[model samples]
Every structure is written in C-alpha cells, then in structure tokens.
Target chain A: MNPMQRVMTAMGQAEPDRVPLFILATMHGARDLGLSIKDYYSRAEHVVEGQLRLREKYRSDCLNPAFYAAVEVEAFGGETIFIEDGPPNAGAPVLRQDADIDRVKVPRLEDCPGLQRGLEAIRQLKAQVGDDIPILGSVISPFSLPIMQMGFEHYLDFLYGQPERFDRLMAVNQAFCVTWANAQLEAGATAIGYADPLASTTLLPRAFYLKTGHRVALDTLPRIRGSVAIHLGSGRGLSLADDFAATGTVAVGVSAQEDLGHWKLAAGKRFALLGNLNGVEMRRWSAEDAEREVKRAIAKAGQGGGFILADNHGEIPWQVPDEVLLAIRDAVERWGHYPLDWKE
Target chain B: MLRGGADVDELSSDLRCALESLERSQVEKVLEAAIRIHSPLEVIEGLIMPALEAVGEDWTAGKVALSQVYMSGRICEDLVGRLLPAVAQERGSFPRCAIAVLCDYHLLGKRIVLSVLRASGFNVLDYGRMEAPALVARVLADQVDILLISVLMLPAALKVREVRAGLDALGSRTRIAVGGAPFLFDPELWREVGADAMGRSAADGEAIVRRWAGEGAP
Candidate 1:
C-alpha cells in the first residue's frame, strides 16, 4: 500500500502493510535541504521543497509541510524572530495585559501571511502528491495560541485571576482555529495536526485540560474535513492519552517519556498512537542505535494496529544525519507489520 | 503561631493558612514574613511549596486550571523575588548559582528552583526557558559556581547533556545539577546525563546543592 493508504488504514484502527513512518519536521530538515533558516521562513517554496525532500529521503508515509509550530501564532499578529540555525520564535507577546484581549482580532484566512502561505503549501502538496500521500496541516491550539499572544505568565494569570476573560479569549482563539483548520482542509489537507504543547503536564493539569483544552479540540475537529491528530509534545504524564482520546482526536502524539503500551491501554482502540522516539537521541546516536530504538518502539506499539511511527517531539537538530532517517524508515518497514508474535 | 497541643495536622493547617495569607498579602508583607520566620527553608518548603502544590492539586482536581497555577506561581515568584535581596543582605556574601528550565519552554520549575536557591542564600541567575547550550556556557564562563538545570521534557534533558558536554570541552569547573519532573521520576537519568547530583523537590534540590558545595546539606 502507498503511504497515504497506510496512514489512513492505521488511523481507522486497521492493520497497514507497515507502520506509517512520519518525521514531524525539525530545524534539521531545512539545514539538510541547504535552505537557511531565514529562507525557510520568508520563502513559501523553500518550506515546501524542504518537506518534499524530507519525504523523498525518508519515504515517510505522511507529509508535514512546515517544520515550525509558530506559523499560526505569527499569522495571529505575534512577531516572529528568525534565527540562522534554529526554528523561528514568536516575539514577546504583542498582547501582554488581560485588557489587550479586546484589541485582539482574528485574522481573515487570506490576510494571515503565515496561514495563507501554509494553505498554499498544502494546496501545492496536494497538487503534487494528490491522494498518494496524506498531507497533514498543523495549527497551534487555543490553549497555546493565547500563550503566543499574552506571554505564558500573563496568559496563565488571565486563566486564574480573570477566568471569564480567559474563556472569552479562548472562544475567539478557537474560532480562528476552526477557520484555519477548515481553510487547510479546503486547501487539500487530508488530516489536521494540532500542536497543543502547553496543554501537557509542564503547564496545565489533566483537569484543566478537560475544561479548556478538550472543548477547543471538540470545537475544531468537526470543522476539519478529515481525521484530526492532537500533538502533545513531551512533558507532563501519559495520562493525557485518555484525555486526548476523550477530546475525540483520531490520534495522540505520544512523547518519548510516555510508554506507548500505557497510552494504548489508556486510549483503548478509540485513537491511533503516533511517535515516542526521542529526536534528540536520534541526533546523537548512530543509525544502528536509532534503528534499534525505532524497532523497539514499533514492536511495542505496532502489535494491535493504531500506530503511526514518528518522532516523539519536533525541532530535530541538524546533527542527526540523513542516514538515521533512512535507518528509521528501514526499521519501520522491517518490524511494523501486524499479526506478529508478542513474544518477539 | 503554633497553638498549644498542636499536632501535625494543626501545624499543617496553620502553615496553609499562613501561606494563603501570604499569597494574598502584598509583596512587602510576604517579604517581611520571610524575614521574620526563624526557618526560611521551612517557610519555603513547608509553606510556599505546599501551597503551590495545593494549587497544582486543585488544578488536577478541576477546581482550578493552568491559569490558576500560573497565577499562583507568578505571585509566589514575585514574593520570592522581593524576599531575595533582604535575605541576601542578612546572609552576607554567598556563592552564586544559575537556575534555568534548560531547553524546554516551561519556566515554572525553573522559577521554583530559583526561589529555593535564593531563599537558601545563594545568588541565583535564572535563564528562564528554551535556553541554548551556548548561553549556559557563557553563564558558566562568568564564574557561577553551580549550574542548576531543570526540564519537563526528555528531549530537553538531552540538551542538559549538550550543555555538560560544552562545559566539559571548555574545561569549566562549574558543578552541574539537574532536577524536574522527568529527572525526579527517572533516577538513572542523573548518571546518564553526568550531572553531579539530582533532586526531586525544591527543598531537596537546595539540600543537594548545599551538600555539593561542602556546606552540609540544607
């Protein structure tokens, strides 16, 4: 089966011929494609070409058009600071005070430069690869979008000291998210990958997740025309598995700190599981070592289906050689098939 | 403020009430209380940490949320910042340390570490979050005696190793220590990252730093 079919099969909780390997892009992919970080940010085609090269090099089952998670925030009026070697960082929030929420206005689909560029990339990818590859478009979730606007501390204060205001801000953020997700879907994204990194243990509790995060996910999922995957980057605990599943995401991106077996049981058969390989480890280890680790992760999580192989987190360092990506792809191909012995 | 025949529960309750009062109290009031307390460590670990943990628990139980915890942590951070200069004035000269969340983008853990270190009389430089190794090496170059790294993610822990490697390559003599939820739960990681020590809580971390400094554990 092709990569798209394999990913769709896995998303449906069915067995694919092999685990659908995906490399959530890192700064490294841009460097590998010889595009400077500035070019990657300023030029839309640079980003698309980098994604295409990474897909071709690793033969990944999924194609992610952008490497950075700050795109949507940038589109929402957050100043973006580009570095020579690292991914762009949204500048210190434009809306620092709680009162500034009234000043915050959602951007139109065409007016958002980053989101527009992202949608165009998705359209281009769909035109190039069509249904042959599952193009996944990404957006920062409401919980994190506020973090981009008001700074982490300020947003947290509004959440606690001024909760009614926080709820209103979240409503506005969620509306934009719905709009963005729909635009991406209309532009040819087969799946929506929502990166809600701050919603994890490092910043919020599982209870807060249900109150604020779950609603955002539920509200945005229906707006997208395809399957939705919630990417909760590392930190916190694996308990988010059930929460993400409860949010009605088709897949939950598990970090390296979490055991896939544990999340699988927590999520049950309701949601597919993606990733747990430590990208930093891959950067430092040999291809052989990476292959061994990838094989172990696949064997552990691929047994009963609902598994798509990917890095536990993004922002992959440039030092991780191309050979390691190939090694990971080869390992998934070798060990990802179903109906295997659990004893192995 | 201990009552006659007070048990652990009563003392804990008293401490909790004291903390709640401090949380609501202006920055000056909290600083004054910190100075007035005989055991600043107890005030920090027993009073402040527990209060923050209670907020965290409230967040976990759904009574509160991230906003609440963030606000509480920020308030506590401000109170600690107010108390630091006075505490340092009383303690006289002390060794300096740099506390940070390392490569991760979460600053709450790093803030707690800074508060504990400052309360313990160490001059602390806090580098917030998502700090690269180069920035850390520059801090080490400034002659900070100890480097305290905290991270919530496993990938960020690897950045700790990168920082360690950078220091090693530079032949810097700064002692390295790491703590956070990930390291707290995974003991073997301390040795894996080659940190001089690791601690589970802010109090424990201060104690470890004191022990490593040859001042006897706090």
Candidate 2:
C-alpha cells in the first residue's frame, strides 16, 4: 500500500502493510536543510523544502506542513521570537488585560504573515507530494491559543476569574481556529491536527475541560473541512478518551506518560492513536533503545490497527540526532507490521 | 468554624478543598479561620503550606489539573503576602537563594516554587524571568548561593547548562536546582544540564533549599 493508503487503512481500523509512521518532526526540518530554525520557518518554500527533505531522508508516512504553534499568536498582533535551535516562541503576550479581549479581533488569514507562510507551505507540499503522503496542518485550539495570547498564568486567571470575558475571548479565538483550519483544508491538508494541550486532563480537571475546552472543541472540530486529529502534546489525555471521541476527532495524540494498550482500549476504535513515544528521551536514545521502544509501542498498541506511530509530544526536539530518528524509522519497519508477531 | 480551635490537618484539608475548587473566598475564609486560631507563621506552615503541597500531590496523581495547581499557588501567594510581615521574622539564616524562569516565558512553575519556598520561610529572591547571562550576572551581583531554574521546553532546559557554565566561569559557588516539564519528562535531564538538584514538584523546591541550607526536613 502507498503511504496515504496505509494511513487511511489504519484510520479505518484495519491492518495495513505496516503501522504508519507520523513522526512529528516539524522543527527538525531546519536541521535537514542546514537552515537556521528561524529562516527555515519564515518562508513557505523553505518549509516545504525542509519537509520534503525530511520525508525523503526518513521515509516517514506524513509531512507536517504546520510551523511552530506560536505563529498562530501572530494573528493576535503578537510577535514571535525565532530561536536558533528551537521552535519560535510567542513574544510578549498580546492579551495583557481584560479589556484587551474586547479589542482582540480575529484577523484575516491572508493578513497574518506567519500563518500565511504555513498555509502556503501546506499548499506547496500538497502540490509536490500530491495524494501520496498525508500532509497534516495544525492549529492551536481556541482554548489552547489563549496560552500564547495572554500567557499561561494570566490565561488561567482569565479562565477561572472572569467567565464572561473568557467566553468572549474564546469566541474570538474559535472564529480564528475554524477559519485557519478550513483554510488549511482548502490548501490541501488531508487532516487538521487540532493542537489543544490545555484540553488534556493534566492541565485542567476533567470537569472543567468538559465545560470549557471540550465545549469549544465540540463546537470547532466539525467546522473544519477535513478530518481532525486532536494533539495534546505533553498533556496526559487517556482519561479524556471519551471526551475526545465526543468531539468527533478522527485521532487523539497520546502522551508518553500514558499506557498505549490502555489508551487503545479506552479509545476503542473510535479514533486513530498517534503517539506515546517519549520524544524528550529520543535525543539520548541509542539505536537499540530506539528499537526496543518502537517494538514495545507496536506490541502494545499495534494489535488491530487504528494506530499511527509518532512521538507523544507532537514535536521532535531539535537536539535529537539524525541517527536516533533513523533508528526509529528502521525499527518501525522491522516491528510495525501486522499479523501479531511481537510478544507482550 | 476553624476560628475556635481547628486542627492543622482539618484546616489543611479545608484549604486544599477550597483551592482545588478554585474558590478564593473559601480559601480566604479557611485562612482567616486558621489565622484566628494560630499565629500567621503557624497558619502558613501548618495549614497553607500543607494544603498547597496536597494540591501539588493531587496534580502529580492526576486527581487535579495544572490550572488548579497554578491558581492554588496564586491564591496562596496573595494570602501569604498579607501574612509575610509575621512570617518574615521566622526566616532562617540560610544561604542566599533565588529562582527564575530561565529563557522561558512559562512562569507557573517558578511562581509555584517561589510560593512554596516563601511559605516555608526561605526568603527566596524571585528573579522573575532571565536569560542565562542576566541570570548569571544577577547570581553574582546578589552573591546568590543557590539558584533554582524552571523551564517548560527542552531548548530552555538545555540552556541550563549555559547558566551553569556561566556561573562556573565567574568562579561562583551557586548551586543550580532545575525543574519543569523537560526535567520531569527525562529524569536525567537535570544531570545532563549540569544542575546540582532536580525538583520533581513545587514542594520539592523547599526541600532542596532546606538541604542546601543545612536545615532539617520541613
């Protein structure tokens, strides 16, 4: 089967030629092309070239056309600081006060240079790869975007202290999320990776999320034009399996802290699973350790398909060596096939 | 009802319950009642500190959320501010200590650790946010003996080595304690970054400070 076919088969809860690899090597593309992380993410052509090179080098099944999550903050008039060795971080928060919520409006996608770069990258990647590889586009969920807009501590205060203002901000952000997501779909992304780390139970109580982020997600996912994969990054989300399923997401990104087998059982074929590998440790992993982890992951969650092998955090750190990622690729090829040859 | 004669355990439980629910008024009431019964230092050590520690434990157990843990610390920081006049006198003679979010915008971890350390009467200097050079400069300027750093990402966590090397180059005797998501994700990350200690939780910050100060367990 082709790469897209393999991913589609897995999403359909059927065994494919092997488990599809969705390495979240979004930032590592810079290293692939010897471009500064800042410059590589600045232009669509650069991003596409880096992604293609990464895919060609690693032979992974997915191309992440998404840039750093901070780019979404640029829409709110926030600046981003592009580091040399890491993903760009949102600059000074845009929403500093309660009144700023009233002032912050959802900007046109074309107006935001950073977001435009991402959309164009997705379009270019789709033009280049066609339907052979799944190109995933990402948007920070409305609930999570506020973290970049108003900073984490201030955002949490706004969330807990001022309910009405928080709702208004969510309304503004929700509009941007849907618009950005649909635009990505229009740009030729096969699926939208709705990055919502705040929705994870690790960051918020299940009850609180059910009322806030869960409602926002349930409201936002369907508006997107294509399949949506909910990514929680480092956030633990196993307990929210049913909650995620309720959002109509096609897949949920699992954290390394969770048990993959238990997550599969909890998800119950509702959506494809896309992680649980500890990305932080990948930088120091030997080839044998990488192989062992890949085999263990496939053994635990690759039983009946509906699994996309990926790093749990939705990103591979910049420091991870090429050999480590190559080891993961080779290991997946060795141990990711179906028909149950691996032991528990 | 703790105004009359509430025990520390009961007060701590009430405070924890109020904090977990994000009810600042209820938390204030619990604090008021505890303060009425005991000295401010006693209330902080016996009630506020223990309650916040419980909240941290709940967060670790996934029984509570990070927002709850963060807000709980914020609320206690506010309340503890009022009690600082009384608590200040109890500050033990220890090495100069400071904490900062090193090259990371995330401050929730640093905020919680600062609150925990202050509540424990450590008199820690809050370095707000600083890059490695600024942090090293401040450590030297203040002659800080122990430096606690928090970072939420791998890049910032890796920057800890820069902070360590900067201090070492200056011939500073500043010991580094590192915490946050990266350190928690990789147990050896603190060592990899040349930190002297790793705090798994906010409460761990107080223990590290106490150990460095040659003090007994809290």
Candidate 3:
C-alpha cells in the first residue's frame, strides 16, 4: 500500500499492510547528517535536509513539520529565546496583566512571520516527499498557548479568579490554533499533531483536563481537514484516554509508561494508540537494548491494528546514534505485522 | 495545660479555614485568616500547602484544571504577600538565598519553592521565569548562600547546564539546588546539571536547604 493509504487506513481503524511506524524526527536526525543543532534550527535548508534524510532512513509513514514546541507562541508575537544546543523557548510572557486578554489577537497564517516560516517548511516537505509520506503539521493546543502568551500564574489566575475572562482568552487562542491548522492543511499537511505537553498526568488532574482541555480540543479538532493526533506527552494521565478519544481525536499518543492494552480498553476500539518508547532510554541504551525494548512495545501494543510506533515524545537528543534508530525500524519491520496471535 | 489545648484547637481551626478558603479561590479571605493566626508555618504548611495539594488532587481527579491549580497558587501568593512583612518583622531577618526558575516557562514549581523557602526563613530573591544564566550569575555575585532552581520541561532542564557553566566561569561559591517534575522524571538530571542537592517536594527542598546550610536536615 502507498504511505498515505497505509497511514489513513490505520488512522481510520482498519487493517493496513502492517502497523505504520510513525517516528517523530528529532535533533538526532540532524546530528546524523553531521549538522550542528544551531545550524539545523536557524537555516531552513538545514532543517529540510535533516528531515529528508530522516524520512529516507526510517521510511516511516508520518512527517512532522514542527522543529520545536515554541513555534506557535513565537508566531503569536511572543519572544523566542534561542540557545545553541536546545529547542528555542518562549521568552517571558508578553501579556503579564489580566487586561491584556482584550488586546490578544490570533495571527494570520500569511502575516505571522514564524507561522509563515513553519508553513513554508511544510510546503517544502510537500514538494519534496508529499506523495511518499503523510505530513503531520504540529500546533500547540489552545490550553497551553495562553500560558505561553501570559505567564502560567496570570493564565491560571484568569481561569480561577475570573473564569469568564479565561474562557475569552481560550476562545481567542483556540481560534488562533484553528487558523494555523487550517493554513497547514491548505499547505498540504495531511494530519494535525496537537501537543499539550503541560496537559500531562503529573501536571493536571482528570477533572480539569475534562473541563478545560477536553472542550478546547473538541473545538479545535474539527477545524483541521485531516486526521488529528492528540499527544498527552506525559504518561501521568492514562485514565483520561477515554476523555481524550471522546474529543474525536483520530489517535491518542501515550508515553513510555502507558499500557496500550489499558488505553484500548479505556478509549475503546476506535481510538488508535501511538508511542510508549522512552526517549532518554533510546538515547542512552545500546542498539541491542533498544531493539529489545522496541520489540517488547510492539509485542504488547502492536496486536490487531490501531498502533503507531513512535518515541514517547519528540526532541530526541543529538547523542542518540543513527544505528539505534535503524534498529528500532528493523525491529518494527520484523515483528509489527497485524492480526498476530498472542500465543506467539 | 488544659487551656493550652483550647488554644491549639483554635489555631488548627483557623489554619483549616484559611486553607479551605484558599481552595475556594478566596485569596483575600485566606490572606486575612492567615494573618489572624499567630503561627506562620502553621498557616503555610498546615493551611496553604495542604490547600494547594488539595487543588493538585482535584486536578489529578479531573475535578479541577490547570487554571484552578494556577488560581490556588496565586491565592496562596496573595496570602504570602501579607505574611511576608509580618514574618520579617517578627523574625528580624531572612536567610540569604537566591531562588529562581532554571529554564522552563512553567513557574508554579518556582513559586511553590519560593513560598516554602520564605516560610522556612529564607530571604529569597525571586528572578521569575525564563531567567538567563547571566542574570543568575549576577545574583550569585551578591554572595548568596544558596541557589534554588526549579525546572518543569526537559528542554527547559537543559538550560541548567548553561547556569552551571556560567557559575563555573564566575568561580562562585553559592551552592546550587534543583527540584521539580523534570527531576522526578529524570533523577540523573540533577547530577547532569551539577546541582548541589535535589528535592522532590517543597518540604524535601526545605530539608535539603537546611542540610546544605549546616543547620542539619529537617
């Protein structure tokens, strides 16, 4: 089957040729190409080249356009503090006061420089490998974007002290995400990868996630044309699987700690589960150990169908060897066929 | 002694009321009640921290959201604002410690530590969020006894090395301490960042700070 057909079939909860391996490329991809992290982030050509090399190496199904998590906030007029070796961080929130919510506006896709740059990268990926791989555009969830604009304190205060204002801020932020997602879809992105890193088990309780994150996700998911993958990057809130799946997300990405069988049970048969591999472990472990762990994850989660093999989260460190990543791909190829019996 | 029992009951009741008020997001009322109580640590550990923990539990159970957690934190801060001066007046001095966020944009951990350290008698100079390594160096130059850095994100935790490198370059003597979710998830991260001590909670941080200061760990 074609890459798009395979991914879409799996996303649609049907059997594919095999379980599609969706590896979210990281700085390790660039390091494999012998490019420095600084050059990889700053230069568009370096980023594209790195991704192309990764796509060629993994022969994976998905292509993510996000290099770092701070892109959306940067586009929304927040300052981005760049470091030599790590992902750029959003500087101190621009909107410190509660009243600044009134002035907060969603950036237009073409007008916002950072979003424009991101969209351009997606467009470039489309031109280069649109047919061979499914391009998934990354967007920060609205629940997190406001925290990026206003500091976490101010944002949380707005939620509790003045819920009405909090709702307004969320509405604007969600609208901003919708606008960006729509633009990415138009730019040839086949799926929208929504990352709410802070919306994890350790950070938020299930009730708060249901009230705030769930509703915002429901609002934002429909805005995109293609499939939506909701990544609760932290492993803390596995109990919210049903809640996450109920938001109409095509797939729910779990962390290294989540049991895929448990998620399938909680989220029901409809929700496809992706991920369980530890990023730190993958970076540090031997190729043989990496293979063993990947095989274990596949055996546990790669049963009937409805699973995508990926890192627990994005941002694989540069120190992880390319051969280790290749071992993961090889293990998936050897063992990830669908409709396998548990007795094996 | 019997009369002293009644006084303890009153203080506990007052502390409970203050905490409950905080959980309800009644910032002003909680602050007022905290002032009404005589034991500041009781107000903090008994009333404030417990309230925050309750909110945290509510968040985990899906009863409350991040908004509620942040709201509870702010309300607690409001109470801290009122209590700070009173504590300063009574204690006559605060410990010499520089408290700041290490790398992540998430500041809840920093705020919690700041409050706990203040309650534990530390004169904290809070540098807020996204603090540069250079700024931390300048603060350390003031001859602070201890430096507390809180991180939440992995990408943010990487910035700790930058702070460490900066401190090394400056040849400063201030002891460095690290804590928060990142450390909980990746314990070796503390050693990687060259922190003098690592803590898992506010109480743990207090103990570690005391031990580092030669006051004996609580």
Task: Put down candidate 2 lDDT per residue, A1-344, tens digits, no spaces.
Answer: 98999999999999999999987787788776788888788789998998998898888999987788888888878898887777788999999987788888888988899888888999999998899999998889999998888888888888887888878888889999999999999999999989999998888888898989999999899888889999998789888999999999999998888899999899998998998789899899999999999988898889889998999998888889999999999999888877767665
lDDT of 3 by residue, B32-117 (tens): 55556546655554555555555545543444444444445555555576555465455454446677876566787787666656
Please state how well chain A of candidate 3 matches the true chain A, as a TM-score.
0.92
lDDT against the true structure, each candidate: 0.69, 0.86, 0.68
What's the TM for chain B in candidate 2? Answer: 0.88
Question: So what's the TM-score on candidate 1?
Answer: 0.81
Off by over 4 Å in 1: A342-344, B1-9, B13-86, B89-92, B98-109, B118-143, B147-205, B213-218
Query: Candidate 1 overall Cα lDDT vs. reference?
Result: 0.69
lDDT of 1 by residue, B1-218 (tens): 22233343444565455444334465345445444643554455555555555654554344443444444555666666655435455545555667877766556567656654654455677766645666556666667777788876565775677777777777776777887755643566777887888866565666666666676222
* Residues A261-328 of candidate 1: C-alpha lDDT, one tens digit per residue: 78877877888888888765565567678778887787778866789888876445555677787788
**Which one wins on DockQ?**
2
Give each candidate's interface RMSD in Å.
Answer: 5.6, 0.9, 3.8
Number of the predicted model whose lDDT against the real structure is largest = 2
Which pairs, if any, clash in model 2?
Answer: none
RMSD values for the candidates in order, in angstroms, are: 5.0, 2.3, 4.1
Query: Residue A46 in candidate 2 has what lDDT?
Result: 90
The docking category that best describes candidate 3 is acceptable
* Candidate 2 TM-score to native: 0.96
TM-score of 3: 0.84
Off by over 4 Å in 3: A14-17, A29-45, A198-201, A339-344, B1-38, B41-73, B88-95, B103-106, B119-121, B128-140, B153-174, B211-218
